[model samples]
Target chain A: MTNAPEITGETDIAPPVSSTGIVAWMRERLFSSPLNIIMTVLCGLLVIATLPPFIEWALIKAVWISPTADACRAARGGACWAFIAEKHRLILFGLYPYDEQWRPLLAALVNIALIVASCMRRFWNIRLLYIWGIGLVLISWLMWGGVLGLSYVENTKWGGLPLTLILATFGVGFAFPFGIVLALGRRSNMPAIKTLCIMYIELIRGVPLISLLFMSSVMLPLFFPEGFSIDKLLRAQIAIIMFAAAYIAEVVRGGLQAIPKGQYEAADALGLSYWKKTGLIILPQALKIVIPPMVSLFIAMFKDTSLVVIIGIFDLMNATKASLTDTAWKGFAVESYIFVSIIYFVFCFSMSKYSQQLEARLATGHKR
Target chain B: MKKVKATAFAVLAMVAAGSVGMAASPALAGATFDAVKARGILQCGVNTALGGFSAPDSKGEWQGIDVDVCRAVAAAMFGDASKVRFSPLTSQARLTALQSGEIDMLSRNTTLTLQRDAAIGLNPTGVTFYDGQGFLVPKKLNVKSAKELGGATVCVQSGSTTELNLADYFRAQKMEFKPVVFEKLEELVAAFFAGRCDVYTSDASQLASGRALQAPNPDDYVILPEIISKEPLGPFVRHGDDQWHDVVRWSLFAMIEAEEYGITSKNVDEMLKSNDPNVKRILGVTPGMGKALGLDDKWAYNIIKLVGNYGESYERNVGSGSKLNLPRGYNAQWSKGGLLYAWPIR
Candidate 1:
């Protein structure tokens, strides 16, 4: 009765200021305990010590444009972005004939378009396969131009970003199906097929990709009869495909294992053939589960394409290294590396983000 | 047990047959030359990137002393310098590329060595550039002589002859030094410039180029006036192809001889009419030299005309005209107190 007597329409007082808003958030999150306070202060000190100098070096004092390296050297401690400006073509198109650089630029754009289209769920059909087929053929024609009005440019002359994209795209395109086959073989009841798949996967996975590239570039030629040679780029491509297939097989196998036995039984009870069951039921679900890992592998493979530099294939990383070989721009390696790292990050980061979105989109069925 | 024995026998037979097949094809002297002619392009392996030695220019045209040697060979073979395809190869891949015929020849700044010449199925065509290992040190060290440094940290590339020479020189001088090694030239150079090491050792020409180009301030570092470890960098062809070897060897010689005769690319046509018998012989007016090498009568003339002489290549690539700006010391002609003495063209 005494409490009820005080029923006035007064607004409730705000929670203690320290327990709400950004100030409260800071207190609760950053200064809740001595350990947290110490960590926050240490992090703040680290940022203070590093950020300004980095900003000054990378942006404020950096030379964005210069006619020659001397102008960059004049800026001294700051980044020489002019080196990248002068060498961008050499880094992007590589030793491809300078006048014909447009071909590679177009080819790269086409490949990027195909990748974008493939990412879209609406294009997930036989039509996408046709698009990829046509896109690859066009890329090959553009790169090794013996047909049409395009003059012949040897694969040896193909390099830089276009080369990197070709290697990665073709590597994944070929390896995905091959990997699925390997995964199925590994899971087969036939001992011989299973053994062979296991051996291949284990053997390929056992060695580093560098060794595989070396074998293809160096040792494979020795085994061939003199004067009978495969194209160096082709050989390198095969090595990458084989190497990627091994890793992808394991990833697909993980996805296959995650599928419930009931799903398999359900397909079987529906009186579906093995191929039909795999293609319609098992594969769709298994591939959906593996999208995240598959994208991760793709990103890994995209970066790993840089390893072709060891075999002297002028991939993006190799071309960047080659560009630094210019005596005039030699000391600006840091800027060049950062530039290429950003290119790689853009590609990898997008793939990761797309994979997350895809996971969410495909995960709607499982939601409560 | 019987099956194992049979398998072993079959493997032995196959290996034997393979060896016999290989031996039968040994000394196919004109094989490479014919292949080059048939292909209409010389697949020349050059350094992936070595600045003054072999590296692509801004226009994506390869420009270097090593590249010139390959171009000269192509000019001699096809009567056109542009008929050359450059395969930029890493140091580890160069010898294999040559031995396996992945390249028609390797003009990749490879040093002439007994193991390479005799054991690796490659024959050194000729010395294209005379290089020597030397030390580069920051001037602030105030070190006048390499011998004066008793204890200094040295940055060198691993898996190079320079590394061995560094260890040997230090041990011979009875000086104690710590070695900081890197697998990449960029990292090694960066480390040296960052003061991680007191000395950076490489080919003297490379040091000059590195100082001139890579240094934040070229004046801050000095190449010591001591040259150790002879590096007779040269072009190489597979060993079984003697005709190809001869063509490559004489192509280099033609450049040197052309330099000796003062036959510049600009004056090559004018010099063709000269009455000098040696000039006539070299320029292929004599005809026998070309026939001996299994090339057209105008082979040497094509080389001199299209690719320029050795001295011109030197100046254009690594001398005063280039960023390297290295002095022509040991690389100069024999008459000029240097080691480049071409065998007589006749």
Candidate 2:
């Protein structure tokens, strides 16, 4: 070797072009073998086939600012975004009086703000409860508007995104604590308590949500005295709460079962009472283990709010449907639905990403 | 164990007592009327959204022929058309809402039938809109008549009389058809428009609505002339509430009777000076009619003045003035060769 190079301090020649750069990288990762080459070509061909048509339909030929549906119709096969533009107010605020829609808008914003604040670790304290209580009262005031210089709006007039948020937020807020109690009752030493909890959970879980809604909406009125009917929104909210509580209890029980027996024994060895043991030791770990599933359940319930349309409650999905009934702007259901689905996706995806972040952040003792 | 048993017994007793206290009396004739007056607003059940039948307009005001029926009833009862609140009900919940007294009356587009009237404890007030099953086909198909729809694929909404009528029509004709049924109206209409089906069948009014509103080009689809079944859509109330039924019934009849007598919203004040004895009797210029119906002397006048006659409402909502543009063929007055024969106000 000393003889070949004459001890010259020279860099080695660059590697072959086929083994580096984007071309080399593509060759190695995508075209390394015959199967890989075929798969890459096929996938590329699929993208080529679908992407342009979708892009053209969604954007290139889409009508954005047409005053009448005729302009949208003239575009033929393109998306009619002008329908959404025309009906956005109706789809967002529902049958709330048009002049006073600002109230529902304000209420929705207040709710969103509270939800955002609740997500922050800095606000995870008793103060958060106070904030939520105040926020809810304010939301009710804005929606009902019987006092404080605001004109009154009936609850029946409420619809759209505000109604959806109210249903989902209040449903989970009350159900979470109720569910924890139910989970505890199921594991209680008292036979009666355990049996009652089991019966409630099983009965609720056995039936579909639609039947529960039907019972609440259609049958409940028949049971009540004439002229004593409950508010439709309240009845639906109760149904959602009951339905969600049963599922949440089951999920919490799964988390409770996951906790090691050693941990319970350790808590007992520390002279902790039953309540203290649960509150200080068992629940924290159990609930932590269930954050992902809990978030998943929340995401599901958020979407399930759409089912209220069957009972004719004008939540966001129903509002969109009602807007479609406008003969002036019909046949653009695909655009309308796509807009709503994107809204749902944004909220659900945000919840999912936040849960992942939360899991990571709360992974203190469990991390490798 | 003893304490738990005692508590359970107590809870059961309380529930039983509560239900007994709230138990409904066999609905008396004027229960709904009294309840509506006490509540200060007539709670009327209507379709959540069926275009010209019952739907909220852009300003969030309930606008439709069904909604006008409710307003007419309110005007008759309270002398104020605005004194009505609408409960937008799905087709499934409409009857239940009326029966439970949650709604004072149901002006939803419910087709009157023997089963609904006899078995379900409901009574039809009167026919508000006379509809019938019809077919919709694309203009490209050049389908001149529904009879020619042999070996055709038809799109129809499931769990509706529309589906049954489609089957019956095909069976009677001895024609073969592939039915593409969907649970949703939107999906069924989309299937028809997408060329998945050769024809779409539903109520004629709905077909016209779908064509006028939903067709990419309104002129591209045509509703055939053939009607296959009777769909006498009307207002209905609980069977036991006969006085309430009469009030609701006469509210609609007053609108029709007013139209027949040539009384309109614009001419009602001038018609107060009408020389006709029928007009004088109906306008409450004579008092016995109101006393018989247990309403104000000016009840009929209030209805005509506030909500207008049936013809005016029809033309304004679903006829030439609106997007639906449904012809008032069978809905026209009896003297005009249509079937709308209002019973005498007296």
Candidate 3:
């Protein structure tokens, strides 16, 4: 902090900050270097050009509710939000009988709760493992039920935001442990094991999500004998888990590589087994360092959840599309897409923001 | 912090101003067909592949009931059905493409409804085929009727009338069933075949088309006798141009009327010379109908000659003579006890 006494007669002391004036300090921080000035001006112009039109179309001029298309149709433009009004429940709940949508809604709450708990720095331990396990079982039970006099809702009827959350959460949740195993195997002294893991990860990472979905939606049945049919949603979920695991394995491998040789040597000196050393010493520090990328992986998986719509899963994107068929809200496609985009952007942005916070917090313990 | 707030506020202000500008323009007016003709090509949207309805053959030649309507319109305008360029659209993409003027006409076996015509600014010409949602189940399920398939998982295409109609029908029948909805028609068919769902539900014609491909045995699946909802499928034009609507609508009506008069594409040229006043007027031997629609003297004759009449297109694509072997049920002409009764072209 700069300390200076008030100068009654001398001009040595700095002036106090004025509310309206463009201070030297503000200018130095915001537009100090040429690059800073350029970036600021460019970003400012970009925001100016894009933001207002989006906000105006999406919110200010958007019709929140209307009985019919004609009601929303004026000489002037208005979003015929009546499509959403009529089909919102269908999109949110899919074929899940309307009366039973509360089950999926509650399951979605569990995902939110688990996400909130996982983000707290203090809860980042063994308790998280418990939370994830319990959360998954509870959510699954609620979504696909045969209990408590609640009529069972088949997996095919599972959809909307809950379906998206389930796919992403379970995909990343199951993939994390599988990824660690695969990453370790890739770096193993046993050549056969290393080659196997390498092949699995490379093959999956090389293909697009659509092809994987096709294989799951089309090829999986051929692989399973006749008369043995797995639920379509389960098949998609399995494909996503396997696909995410391969990418997560690569991310985990990068984290594994960044660990100093001394940590392994220290564990070896203490006569620690490979599993013991990895679980206690290596994984903790490595995961801490790679936390940002891991969060990014989760976000990618979340976005990838939408592609399941191609295979016929009524995830949020599919739901939005289904609503468009309502005819009364046919022309309001732009409004509906913008709404879907906002839903996606909010989730992605918050995850990124949390990743930034975690990266800053974890940086205190590690140099690299 | 202040700068961020200022930028956000500025953006909101701009969007509000832009929206006000958009409001000044009129909505729900269709002017696309004239625009397409002015652009010198008819943009006719069809399906990527649905064998007898709309699909390309081995030679990359597009054929089918829906494709013929598109071609007939093209032949009427440019005097060659071959002049029309086909834009293959998925179900999700079809309506948006039409609304956005990406395609001038949508002749993709799309069902017509008051909501679709009014909401999308499309003027549905007339029902070309009367269809209804039906269920296709494997023989082993032993489902004798749609009612027997209660509590069964039924695969249905998403964003379709089939989805809502399935719910409405099952509820009315007091039947309990689970719907496994897919967005793509192809995927839904595949899923149904794979036993992802016990029953495949769609337009009866589509059910036949899909059932033809299922494995184990061709005869293993059976389409139930029940018809769930009325699917009055037809061709459509954008809303604004009443002139263009008349052209398309009359083209379809002339084809049906010609068939009712026992006129085939092979005999259309001869029929043009007939003493029958109604036939002569429709063939454009009379000037008023052709002149009023801004069409050539032989527009109806050209459509019939190039694309054939309605019956010819049907029999060639999906009727008893075709691979699909769909019976001429509700799609038969009005004189043949079907619901298809075209308004007199005169």
Candidate 4:
């Protein structure tokens, strides 16, 4: 039995070449059982039935550029992309001065670059924090231009893609540390600190973000002393930070709780201080365990920035909505909404991919 | 722009909303006029998207009747209409934005009502457009009258005055109708277009604007003749700033006055040479009116030059000159047998 098989390299020759490209894989999985085959065939037929007419309606016969709504309504029955072409500027930058739109364009680019940089494995160190901090400062200067010899654009005029990025990036960035503090406090032995953290987290989390935004816009003025005015953007920022912090606290707490007690005990045995024990020994592992959920929370926060429209902050969604008011491009909301959806999807999908890559990279030697 | 809405729902009354301005503001808080002057750009709150009311044009310039009110205020304050920055506010957020000083004035087609003025802390500058709640339905429905509709599903904005008015109208007419309410106007419009509801109810002006702009085929819809609620839509500001309120009120009154005097934008320069004290006062050649309003003597001149009179702004945005082609009806001047009457510019 031991000598039955020859210990030759050629004996391990390529196994039978069973057709194994994507097509074969699809055939094996999608058409494996009768039920699966039937389902796949039905789906294929459905797509076949719907796809061409959809393509014709959405692209081939679509009007790319036209002067008026009637021009779009003429001849070909398809989407009027002319609406988007005419209104794209308003949707991209809101009411920002046409001459100085480059400032917002660059600000949005810088933010996107910073987010991309942060997503890289090499930038996962404290250097990432520095990059983000400096990047945000630069973006702020770019957007609210009273410095660097740039023409001043008031915060009210700052809107569209840049506004959405500012709110989401700042909201998530500010939330991470604030969330960590709340999480640590919730886990602390000190009763007062723990209770305070619990109260804040519960209070903010209990309410919808819309109310927080409303209070910031509406009720906040009543609380302020006369003669002092907080900027509307700043008020909304504070609301977003507070709201996101509460949700992030709950997420971070879950991570902190997952850390084994043995890790803390070991750090304590080594005469480590509480901060060192948590920060060095426990937090790294706990945070690693939670990267997936944390990124999911981040994605959710990014999407939530659209809600600022309710408060009159002309973010991307608001700008898109504002563009639809033009009589020249009325009754073509589907095209506009789809384009906005694609914009949102690109950011979210990248975040998801980055989270997956991070999870793989973090697996390392900590299998236990 | 930041507090959570759940906590907000609990404290709906903004307790000192009305009284705080009346009782506490004059001591030191009436700063909107100064703020507008200092900022150099009057922050005017307008509708996020209302056809013929306030909406951004393709080039990102603000347009429409409500927007003209904002331009008038800016011109009155800064002697330049372009010195205004518009904040596109939602119906729900407009009053809050004004009361909280997020905007110096709201020209967002808001209806003047006792509850709004007293409870929400807004002082109506003046009525800009006399509108009324009405119904819009597909022509195929063959419904000649709003009263004819029984068992029809009516779409109304959830928090809008139209919801209550629709209910009242159907009840008063002894008609059975289902109501479909949506939070966003976009959703409501889409629901109507998709045939989810038989009739869409709003102020009649909006119904016409929606027909001309939002409808796939403008000819497919018909606005019903019945006008239910009296919606005297206008610009407003926080109650505390009487100086700002006066400026807003009179600035609007200036437009009406200009229309009354027949001082068209085209003839404004020629009218400046008129010996009539009325034209002189309106064009600011009389001097005292502007000084009384805490602005330069050229304030009304700037308004006429930059934003045009009530009649011009109306026809350009919502009436004959616009796609809506709506009849002036109640919006016509009192001299023309409509409700628009102006206080004489003495």
Candidate 5:
């Protein structure tokens, strides 16, 4: 430790800390004030009370595999990981044919790789478009394989993580373009188009998504002409698209309305056509500004995919729920739910991080 | 001229409405049986998860009484038990699923109430299980009968048949009791186990399963002897199709009659050679039974071979052969002092 210089009237000397290590830092930050000390001690007490038992239950005392609940009970009541170890495949794939699970596993991994690759700033190019275009073709081919000598797997057979991804990604992808169209039409001065847009938005937004899904699953089939049938999965996908598009239209409309009048005036002065003015001048600026809210909406919709459990889609949430139906593992819902929650958190957390990065990259006009 | 045009408009509207009505009730002409045959699979709706009724095993294969019922129908139709798709449904979605034609039939544990049969346009094919609402109490409570729980605080799921039955039973017996209501089965079970209530009330099958599967000590909880309501859980189809209804109803009846003739999945082939007329008729050794249901001559034999008799299913699923271990009390065959009586298969 360095010694303090001798005190003199000519210059001021800062006093040396008694302990100049982590101990000193802890003293200043953790116990420097009365409230701080109290909070720290209380938190320490809480950790002492909860942490060891939790660690013991989750790790140390947990059962790895057991044939029955009797075995789980013969050991003391800790986390019955034996249940998870036994049922993890069922939780991950639902009722997908066991032999063909490699297809869905490949489909899910391809989706994740595409998602991760797209999040990279360097991959933000026209080449990215080609990658997605080709990747989707491959994924579709792999998932619904009738060609290439692979056995035909219907869309109804799709379940678990792949189903969740298919629903969210397809729902948001369709909603984005549909929303833009509705927003533009709503802003259009043409009376009939604006009225139609308003009616659609209000109608979809008026009812809960559950009722919308129910109508699609039930009422739409009855309404269909005799001998005509639609797939149940396709019906649910359409309902999600309709519900999300209405909400997204409102968000895009806010972005469009926020575009300054100066941009419109500038485009008009340049003798630009109406399409050019809106596409180049207005939408480019408006879409950039709305990217944050749009990403948030996408995240919200990702969570809303869980609601399809009500309609029996066997998405990740429902598959996890289905896994716990085993009589051997009947009481261990907490562990199963916690496992699925972690999967959700990982996807959502990465999306949030990507949104922040995109915001920073797109901060062009807000230099000051 | 204006009056004539108005009359023409009314006639056109009536024609359109009549066409839609005809389309809706196409099943009235026995279309569902053909539709199911053309589809090459029977669409069966079942509970999301119930221990003795319908639940997915570790292999993601649904195996229980409700699941087997549908498979039996599949066997009767195609002579193969695997030609069925299970649509797992919540309680709220079950009837809507059947009504909307999403499923051809529902073998879920739905109580066959008069209102359900009439208002919801459901035709109860046959009662599969004679379940009843009952109470469960901790061993420490020392309550041997539901009668002693007059002033007890009971935990029950709100807005369910169990909740309504509990209130009705207390009122009918002229007893005073406090009720703790939870909207979820997990919450009610938790509350009861956490000492928040003195008694837990639900269907006896559910209570027995809950205690066996979830209680800290299975021996600590005992279901009360008094059963208050008749659940009469059964499979049902939409109301317009009596032909399809008979197909489903007689499929179950064949199983019951198979048990009466002592023809199990194991011995069904042997029974096909029996000289006894009843067993011969059930095994389709004697012909003419399948034409009425528009099925093959070996329909009963297929169900018996692929699935099992009612007694076998009972023993394998919810009775002594399974974890729930529910007794064959009211569900026993007619000759064995139980209410399960099927019409003669012949």
Candidate 6:
């Protein structure tokens, strides 16, 4: 190789750093091509028209606290955040016993902790599943008492932020596995089992949540034997789980379909049982591929949780509305609405961003 | 107070709302009146369903206390009580619709509040019915007083004063309770009966009305006697339009004034030719007062002749003659120690 040839020119080491500055970035991405320039201008105008007033209303001029409605003065050109500050507790806690609220708070923390633990790549194992089970049991035990010398509280009295968290956590936690089983069953060669699963998924997906909740609340009682009644929260929870399962099944089915036929043949070549092959070979890759869609589903479920307010379970939105009905804060609806909207937007936007990140990570592994 | 709007499209019938009469745009307040007159109908807002308050009868004709208020206003404006179009609104949508100028006036069973007047930019003309919030629990619960049920779950409409009252009542009793809320009264009531909630709380009259609609047996539930909060139901007009407010306010006052003056719809014409100065002044025999309000002197006469007096409207809608069969407890005439007092027409 002639000793790697002689050294190159002076410019070889640093070809050209192309001016690293805002102006350079602006020129390259925003003004380099005609299409890019047009898109930038369009986006700029959209931001100007939308973002400034929103920022002004939501942050810059918003009153963080006010003793009376006069302090808001809607004409004064600012949001009345004080209304939310005053009633936020009521909106978040609903009818939970005041002193016992610590239980729900602790429960919420545990649930959040479990979710965080599961998200860490280092802890992504079957043991992580126990976190959820333990967390749910601890939460219910903490909230419902009747053990450990704590006073027992009924589920019906559960409302506010705690109720909302419980519904969403339990809803997705139980729904995921159920959805996977349903998807597998639907795709199975067994015609009877497939038909039953297909019918179930379709029927649940066909109706609105309101009707399902109504059926659970009203028609469910009629179906059960006399004196064997389900609690309102349980009825609503079951309806939510069933509703979520149908959607999740469809998503999971897509993931399963994306697995190549060669993988199945390779698993068969290993002489593995059907369950063992599918569980060890197919599920791991399929679930990884479907992470983005699953996250999006979670965000959607969060929004749908608001509908529970309509049926009398005082979720976050319901509690906000309930707090506004106070004669002391009668005209502070705009403030209250904005606060809850912020809460919803923050959670949903973060989830969507996380989903995007997961999609990018997953994309790196799949060259095709 | 039950304030059903009778004339939804009827404002156009008697008013000569020509192209040049006024602006036809909805953005302007008075312009809507011109539009209604041009369209030859009054756009009236009423309740969709509330027994005896503003519900349709067997033949589908709207009847109730609120309906007669609309009819009275329509009769005053158009000289024809039946020349109205009824638009029903849920409680949540009522204020927004009126604020947006979707309807001329809201004659639903809307409560009068200072917040509605100063904050929401709507004017309360007068109280039509004096109601109070109360609780209704199923008989199986065996709860006689609301105070006894400390931890009970209550079903209440999402956006009403009743919700606040429920919280305050329970809190004052040092009892903690959960509330299941719905945006619609019908849905809330249905949920209550379906056993989703332990108690149903609302305006006492509404509790009675909801109970009546329940099948199987209405007697399975009982409305508690504790009156929690004062709910002075009334008609509302949009703010910034003093003339329209005056018209709506006086139209309601005219009914009470007519009842006080013993002027019945059956003999309003005979009273028009009477020698009594009060009757003649109210009947427009003395026309100068109408000039001040920018209306014809015959406005009160048109109101009485078209829609009956206060007592007559109540009896026809919510009292003994109607399905609601609600007694005229606090809605009776001022002479009978009730609150239906009216200022002088002249």
Query: TM-score winner among the candidates?
Result: 1
- lDDT score, candidate 4: 0.83
Which portions of model 1 miss their true places by more than 4 Å?
A1-34, A365-368, B1-30
Fnat for each predicted structure, in order: 0.64, 0.54, 0.00, 0.56, 0.43, 0.00
Question: How do all the candidates rank in terms of TM-score, highest first?
Answer: 1, 2, 4, 5, 3, 6
Cα misplacement distance, residue A81 of candidate 6 (Å): 1.4
Give per-residue CA lDDT, model 6, range B52-139, as digits (tens).
6665432235567788888877777777888776655545446544654556788888888766776555778998888988888999
Q: What is the lDDT of residue A268 in candidate 2?
A: 99
What is candidate 3's lDDT per residue for A92-192, written digit by digit as tens? 66546677788989998999899889889788789898988898889978988898777876575576788888888788878888998999999999999
State which candidate has the highest DockQ.
1
RMSD of 5: 5.4
lDDT of 2 at A188: 91
List chain A TM-scores, every candidate, in order: 0.93, 0.92, 0.87, 0.92, 0.88, 0.87
Q: On a 0 to 100 scale, what is the lDDT of residue A207 in model 5?
A: 91
lDDT tens digits, residue span B1-346, model 4: 1232332332354332532223222122457888888888888989888767888887667889999999998888888898887887876666666765667888988888877777655788899999999999999999999889999999999876689888888899999989988987777887897889999998887787777766777889999898999999999887667888889999999999899998988999999999999999888888898888898988888898889999999999888887777899998999999999888887
Model 4: CA > 4 A from native: A1-19, A365-368, B1-40
Candidate 3 lDDT by residue in tens digits, B1-346 = 3432343344334334542111111122435555656766687888655667765542234667888888888877778777676765555545544543446788888888776777545678987788898988899988788888779998988876689999998899899998888876656766777789899898898787566533335598898999988888888876667888887788788778878877789998888789988888878887677777787878888888888898998898888667567888998877888887988877
Residue runs of model 3 more than 4 Å from their true location after superposition = A1-26, A33-56, A121-127, B1-332, B336-346
Q: How much does each candidate deviate from the true structure in C-alpha RMSD?
A: 4.4, 5.3, 25.3, 4.7, 5.4, 24.0
- Model 5 DockQ, alpha carbons vs. true complex: 0.36
Worst 10 residues of 3 chain B by lDDT: B19-28
**TM-scores for candidates 1 onward, in order:** 0.93, 0.91, 0.53, 0.91, 0.91, 0.52
Candidate 3 lands at a TM-score of: 0.53
Winner on TM-score (3 vs 4): 4
